[model samples]
Target: MEKDAFAQQLPVEKYTRNIENKSIFYVIRKEGDLTKPNFIVSYAWGNYRNDLVMTMFGRLMLLMVGLIVISWLPCLGIARYFTRPLVQMERHVGRMAERDWHEPISTSRKDEIGRLAKAIESMRQRLVRQDRAQQFFLQHTSHELKTPVMVIRSYAQSIQDGVYPKGTLNESVGVIMKEGERLRYRRPEIKWEMDLAPHTTLIGDQEQWKIALENMLDNQLRYAKSCIRIVVKSQSLDNENAVKGQTSLSKFCISNDGPLLDQAIADSLFEPFRSGGDGQFGLGLAIVKQIMDHHGMTVRAANQRDGVSFYIEPGKQTDKTSVPKVS
Candidate 1:
């Protein structure tokens, strides 16, 4: 039984051949003394060493690859986290520039990109408000202009038919009633004061100036708590821009004792149908602006301690006789 077990442990037989000769060798060893050997075995040291080195090298390469993969995971996550918001922001800004009014992006990130997103969203909201205000302006403009036009047309037709239209009398009555109603309704009993520049005139359509003044008065009436003042004065000219014989400019100001206008509202007041305090469409000021533009005059609104003032500056000189006096 001992000999059989030793045979099972022995190395398989092998041989090597060379040009010189063929030979056989067995690599064997005994656990005990060589002289009293109990077991021996054949082994190939060169092949075994080669196999071991190959296995070790393959394992080392696998370890390097795994380490690289593990390290790359966190790097990839960080890069994506930082750049994703930036990419989204770029796309969103492009859309806004194109005037695309899509819903704003929602984000809760507490980073720079998040702040940028919030700012962009705010701008979009402002644009939306303006857009809504523009729609309101169009609707109001249609209604306001249509009534007057229809009434004027009807009156002209009736007059052409040789009929002394009842409108002529009714219109006068209507004006009187409107004035009476305004006096009763306006609070604080607004006083009217006029400081006219005698014979201050420009070469422009008188009718247009009348319309501009009426519009200004209408606005002042709506807002005035105590008094409305109209002042006309000659503006001294700069020597460089004025012709030596040119007449001085006539500066007209309409002021009211009312609440001061906000700086933002004052800046954009003359823009057609701009939104105003209480969301009222500013068509009155717009009309004033249009008439002023036609006559080559500049108009601006300014805040005062007690109220607001609007000034109209003439663009050119005209003979003093051309200007009409205000009652």
Candidate 2:
């Protein structure tokens, strides 16, 4: 059997021989007869590629490298797509921290990030408005304070120099007192005749209107002898001029029985820095005018029999006149 295995010319295979310096290869028989002897064959084919790597192994390594390179682009694109919103949010937050409100944000998206952006944008707008309001307040306040401070200092120096005004010092002292009053909030003794509607609600910043009203009352208080009257009424529009459905216009009027305003002073009463023979600057009325304008209202000063009446028409219709909540 061993001689026949060696002598056979065709390819043949059998159980491996227990010997060194021999190799093995598998091959199929050429005759296609399964029943014949030595139908399978084995031989030692010298290594082709190298001792370090086989041909099959090298092919597999090349295929793996190609796959990794091909997949790199798609992986990078997917990563950027997922992080795009996060990057936008970071930029928006940075702008907010810097107090930049000029750039508007996108609110059209219907997602969680969209909602977050919308909330932040809303906060930015409110902060911008408040900042602008504070700046205006400071500018007006400083301007108003400057004249009084200068006047007080000048008068004090004159008194020290033995130079006095011809009339009593009461008027000079009253100048200082009035300027001081402007800075301090005081509720003085006077009769308040309020004929306000029950609801009396208008679309406005209540605090701002309150400050404006206080300024008006304070100005009147400085001159008023006994009474100050406030009237809030809904004036019905003439049927012919009325809009299709709307009926009445809300109006607020304040009158004081101190003294009738002078015609010249009344003309420039709402202008800043103009005075009415008193030590007070005209900033109070100017501020009132600004507040009315902010609320889209119109204010007019008219001479009354005893004093002056400030008529304010806040342009809107009220739902109903209920007692205003005091809180």
Candidate 3:
């Protein structure tokens, strides 16, 4: 067993000639005299303490064993460190695949592997920024179209309800046409906003910002009974990466206070089509979130004891506008 333990640490050809059928075994025995009641002093495998010389067949076998060990043994050991980062990288890749980017390569080592890890992490962050941008693009478009629709829908309903005088039918139609034109023209302004800033800047779209602010305020106005607190602000965290670094941000945020959203609902409050009140369409907050993202800001909703608060940050809103992309 002792010999076996040693051989196990080695490869197949280390102790045997053939990889197919191997020869290696260990035994245990008792110590003292040989004649001591069937007791064995010790045990060994192919025990010999002399130089092994042999014929061509035997020499060929030994040569093969030497080559295998010399070539591959050291490789296995070195490969462990090289493979370690790759394994960790694989884990990170899987996590990212699951749409998780909360963690990045904080590795500070200066090596090829370390550099590769940082590069991958940087790429991931860029994708995250893109996500925010896409949401803003969509949100801007939807909100612009919704405004006129609201006005027209209201007027149309009012007319049907006898609230409109007989001579005002033409006025209602004119207002509807005006609202329709705004939707048709300004609706695509989101795409125009996106083209104004380079992606590396992590820029924000003004269209998206307005949509988010309106959503928060609208929600508060609809459900808060009376008071609705709305706030918009921007700031940047200093980058530790600078030789003597600066801040970087290109966006803003909108927050509001109302009845506390349920914990479960708040967690997913930014998701589209999610509602928490008596009954709602649930798209309001989702759209707000979508717009905030395009502008490279994060959206957070939390239940304040008396009401609720949401926060926003601009992609380029930070005072340190020169922060590096990777640490």
Among the numbered candidates, top TM-score falls to 1
What TM-score does candidate 3 reach?
0.34
Worst 10 residues of 3 by lDDT: 188-197
The prediction achieving the highest lDDT against the true structure is 1
Query: What's the true lDDT of residue 22 in model 3?
Result: 41
List ranges where model 2 is wrong by over 4 Å.
Answer: 1-20, 25-53, 79-95, 107-123, 143-154, 157-162, 165-171, 189-327
lDDT per prediction? Answer: 0.71, 0.68, 0.58
Error of 2 at 305 (Å): 38
Off by over 4 Å in 3: 1-165, 168-203, 234-257, 314-327
Residue 123 in candidate 2, Cα distance off native in Å: 4.3
Query: Which wins on lDDT, candidate 1 or candidate 2?
Result: 1
Ranking by lDDT: 1, 2, 3
Tens digits of per-residue lDDT for model 1 on 1-327? Answer: 244435544333343323345333344444664355455456444555577899999999999999999989999999999899889878888887887856787789888888988888898887777777888878876776666556666665666675545657666445445544533335457898999765454546778778888888888888888899998887544436444544444688899988888888889999876766656876778898888776668899999888899999976444434544232
The per-candidate count of clashes, in order, stands at 1, 5, 21
